[model samples]
Target: MKYAVFTGATGGLGTLCVKELSRLANWMVFAGGTKEAELEKLGKLPNIIPVRLDVTKQESVNATLEIIKSYTNKLDAIVNFAGMTSFTSLIEGESVEAIEKLLNVNVVGTARVNRTFFDMLYQGHGRIINCSSESGWMTPQPFAGPYVLSKYAVDAYNDSLRRELIYLGIPVIKIQPGSYETNITQQVYENFDKTISNTKYYKKLLTKMKPLMMMELNQKNDSRRLVKTVIHAMESRHPKLKYRVGTGKLLAMLELLPEGGVDVVYKLIFGKQGHL
Candidate 1:
């Protein structure tokens, strides 16, 4: 039986991907956050086994992997959509510790997943999808420093691993979602506020910066786009190296702009983000 695995099965895009992949695979086993309730609900699906997983912790990841490894010797696929975001501006914003957490989950955690399952994917010639960001493209967001940096790492890691795994010929596809209808916008704003209250760097400037928070919260994209993208990536006769989904071609054009120009343009567009 072909089995698939996924991370971040409790939330927005993760939930959508879970449903879509579940339909395609004969059986699906996935990992979730600290919440046991989420795991319980998700496991109720027709052929799903939701395991408690904390991607940032190596030991926790190992323990979860052991259960999965013992269950299935042949794994077909894995999708990484587990991520967190904050609206801290680099020059004048939140704590360094927050940024550290982002790197741990967004960058290191990703590498860990691919590395941990290297043996499985190789032996089975499986596929892996890394949920990258458009911000990692030529469009460098002003207040989204941590997110951009981590995504950039994912992109590069995919490239390096793809080359090394070529003898195995397992496909590695990167999915870049522009924006989708998710409660993440509200969540990020909440994080921004909490981070700002205790932060001293740019408290005054950020206090007045509520517009950027609302703009991100209001940005819209179709959730179905991700479902379609994932399905295509899995079933396509010749899956491309990367696929980007979103409502905006603006960021596409931004990808063509030089680094200097993109930076200048963002400064003109958004005077100040979550940073002072």
Candidate 2:
């Protein structure tokens, strides 16, 4: 039987992906990071196997490996949905520790998870889907520097991995989702508030960015299409190298602008405070 693994399986988008993938009768889904309570709530859905996996921890990775080995030796696909987000401003001299933490989870941790299952993926001629954000390509939003930096790294890592594994028939796919319904915005806002309270600088700029952040959060697109896009990437015989889901024409066009052009646009949008 075809088998797959999805890291960050308990997240908002991850949960949707898992539920939809479980409907595929021919495939087994190893829902990474799921808890016992979640499994019970799922009520023994066919082909959905909940496993306690955390990409950041070696022991958790090892346990997931053992669990997968007990069921199937090959993985047809591995979707990396695990990620970290933070609201940080470079001008504020954001915490080095926070930036490192995001990179470790969003970049290094993802690399480790894929490397652990590399052999199985090669044997199965599997595909890898990494869930990146629109921030991966677009200009960085104010006070969201750390999360944007991590996603930029994710984009580069996906490109390098795809090229590296090409000879082995293991395809790497990137799914860049635009604002979608998730708790990330809340977390980032909370972080921003905490940082502002603790810091002496960027207070006015941070305050200015608050309404914009709230507007962005309110604009979250339904993630159903993103889930379908991921499933297609997994099942398609010849999937595209990158899938940009939910990014509207405006944002899409903005991505084509030169860095200077984008910078101008940002300045216009948020006035002098928008300089990246």
Candidate 3:
């Protein structure tokens, strides 16, 4: 039987992928999350073993490794969906602690889990799939500084890990998904609200940006589309190094411009007064 570990399995997209993966013949999935209730519910599903894991803590990751090791000596795949985000202007919103927490979960947490599980993956000659975001490659948005920074780090981390592991026959793949209908939007909204409430100098600017942020959030694509790409990355014999799903053409076009040209476009969008 094939064995796999899925972090953030309680999340919207992660839950979908875990359920779909459970339907595969002879496949066993260790669905890792910190939520006890959700993990218990997921455990009831066929071929799904729910594991309580907090990627931010090394002890939790080690415990999860022990739990999975008890069931199997090798792991065919490790899909990292465990991540967090913070939406705030770097200069005026969100505390340093909040930014550090975001980086810990989204970047360090991913590295922690992957490094912890590498031995089992090596034993099975498995693949590692990391869920980055379109923001990882796209130009930075106004209020999403912390999140964008974390994803950019993920992009770099994955590239470095992939290069180092390729010679060992371990494929490290990256999934850079566009906005998907997920709880991340809700979290972003909450963070945005906090930013607005706490800002001293950017209140007007944030107010102007609110409508645009709402519009972008509301336009998220169905997350199942992204899940399909995750499945492809998992099951394919030869998956591409990167799978980009539902990314925006405008973002792509903006990226094609010169750095100064991109800055000019942003200036026009938000106006000289910082009103969108």
Candidate 4:
């Protein structure tokens, strides 16, 4: 049986990924999270085993590995879907602390898991699929400073790992999808409130962005489509280095433009005062 370890199985996209992977009879999947009760519930399924994994802590990862030993010695894949995003405005003195928190989870935590599982992946000639976002490359927007920084780091991290893993016959793949229907969007307004509070400039900026945020929440791409693409990356004989799904092209085009061009586009969309 092919065994895979999937982290962040509790998030919106991760939940969908977990559900789909559970349906595959040939695949034995370890759904990773810190919630023991939820993980135990998922473990009730035929091929799914839930493991209490905290990627940020070495001890937790080591403990989880020991559990895996009881099941299988080889791992066919490690899917990192665990991540978080927060809104911030650097100009408003939004602390780098938020960025650090996200990096701890999205970048450092991911590296930790991959490093801990390297032997298993190498022994099985497995793959690593990281869930990134179009924010990795697109021009920075008004309130997503911290999130953009973390995603850019993710893009670079994936690239470096992919190069190193090539000779080892392990594929490091990145899936960059545009806005998808997820809980993240639903929390944007709340994030904005937390980040923009106590700052006059950002409060004004929020007035302008409220409508845009609402519209974006309604415009989320079909998450099932992204899930399908992800499954294809897992099953394909030769997967692409990166998979772009949904509004990826639109965001990619934004990246192609100069900074000034991007600003102009934003102005056109959000108005001269940055209000729709």
Candidate 5:
């Protein structure tokens, strides 16, 4: 039996992926941070079951895996999309909590998902879809340092995991999304003022980054950006190991370029002094 499981199903790309997964898999599990009401509503569908699985909690992850195991020894695909954590440019010591939370949820959470679900993939001979970010390649805006770090770490680990899984004949795929229309930016906005107001080092540029974050806050993701990749990763006979969506070929080329070249390009764009 083919099954699909999704985390972060409450909102953003996760919610959209859950909707799509419902169409493809015989059974679907929706794991969320704290959106039980919505999950219950989604779970009401004949094939969909909403399970509370906070990626940050070991027991929650274990219980969710047990539910999947009970359904079948095999899972077609698992979307590790459980994260609401972000970082503001300012390191207000207060940001430490969020920083830790972001890493714990995104990096450690992904590892936990991979570990718990690999057995099902081995059984069904399927794939693991990890939602990486353009941030995994580069940090564009300020005050989002921790998010960039965590994503970068996840990207690296996924690459390694993908390689290891080849021996098991289960593929691990990565989706690198550009700024999509999602609730993530709202979190950035909510923390924008407090994060900057609490810091003194980057005050001169605070007003500058305001518009950037505000612009980002009001933005919404093209659900298609994520949907298309999720489908390709699941359905295609030869799904790509990495999917880089949106923003045309230029950015794709940029991500492909070596890191030193990328740094030179960044310096050129920002006109910053060379340090290396």
Candidate 6:
């Protein structure tokens, strides 16, 4: 039998992946999340073991490791999806505490879980799948600095981790997905609202940015594509290092420009008075 653990199991993509994984024969899934009610629901599913995990806390990650160890000595796969997003101006609107919290959840949290479960994964020669975002590689936009910074860190962290783990015959895979229909959009909007309320200078800019942000969020693709890519990474004989699903061509094209050129583009978009 194969054993897998999925963090962020209560989330849209996480839940979809867990349900699909549960349908596979001889597979046991540990659905880890912070939501008690959602965990209870997942626990009712066959082959699903709901584990309460708050990846931002070391103790919580350690406790989850202990819980999983009780059931199996080894884990065939560990998929990390526990992440948070922020939509605020880094210099003027967002608090340092808020930025720190975002980093803790999206970057440190992922590392903590992987570190806590390393021994078990090593024992099984398993793979580590990290859910990064298209924002990780694309040229970042204004007001999304915290989230973009966190994802870029994830990308770098995963690259380094993969290089180290390759010697042990454990492949570390990264899934860089584009905007998808997920609860994260709601959280992003909430953060945006809070930023608007708190900002003294970026109010006008943020006001103009709102509709553009809305359009981007509304253009999200079905999240099932991401789930399918994740499953492919888990089950394939030789999975690629990175799987990019539904990435945006325009953002990607922007990434190819020189630093100065990109700066000019942003300046034109936001204008001298910060009106789009």
| Candidate 5 lDDT, 1-276, residue by residue in tens | 467778788877777777766765454554554577778877765567788888878898888888877877788888888765565653455667777888898889988987877777777777898987877875343467778778888899999988887887888889887666667756766676666676656554566556645654444547776787787787789988888765434445666677788778755654532233
CA lDDT of every candidate: 0.73, 0.82, 0.88, 0.81, 0.73, 0.88
Compare the candidates by lDDT and give the number of the best one: 3
Q: Candidate 4 residues 1-71, lDDT tens each?
A: 88988888766787788888888888888889876667777877778888888888899989888888898
| Cα lDDT of model 6 by residue, 1-276, tens digit | 999989999987899899888788878999999999999989888899999999998988888988998999999999999988888777774457767997899899999989999999999888999999999988887778888989999999999999999789999999998877789878898888998999877777678778877877777677778888999999899999999998876577788899889989877776656433
RMSD of each: 3.2, 2.7, 2.0, 2.7, 3.9, 2.0
lDDT of 2 by residue, 129-239 (tens): 998888898876666778889999999999999999897878899999887667675687788788778756566656776776666666758788898899999999999
Residue-level lDDT of model 1, residues 145-224, one tens digit each, is 88778888888988887787676788888887776657666677777777578666656546655665465456666788
Cα deviation at 137, candidate 2, in Å, is: 1.2
Q: How do the residues 200-245 of candidate 3 rate in per-residue lDDT, one tens digit apiece?
A: 7677767887887787667757777887899899989989999998
Screening candidate 4 with a backbone cut-off below 3 angstroms (N, C-alpha, C), the clashing residue pairs are: none
Model 4: CA > 4 A from native: 91-94, 248-253, 267-276
Which residue window of length 10 is worst by lDDT in model 4?
267-276
Output the lDDT of residue 187, model 4.
69
198 in model 6: Cα distance from truth in Å? 2.7
- In model 3, the worst 10-residue window by lDDT is 267-276
User: Which of candidates 1 and 6 reaches a greater TM-score?
Assistant: 6
Regarding TM-score, does 3 or 4 come out ahead?
Answer: 3
Ranking by lDDT: 3, 6, 2, 4, 1, 5
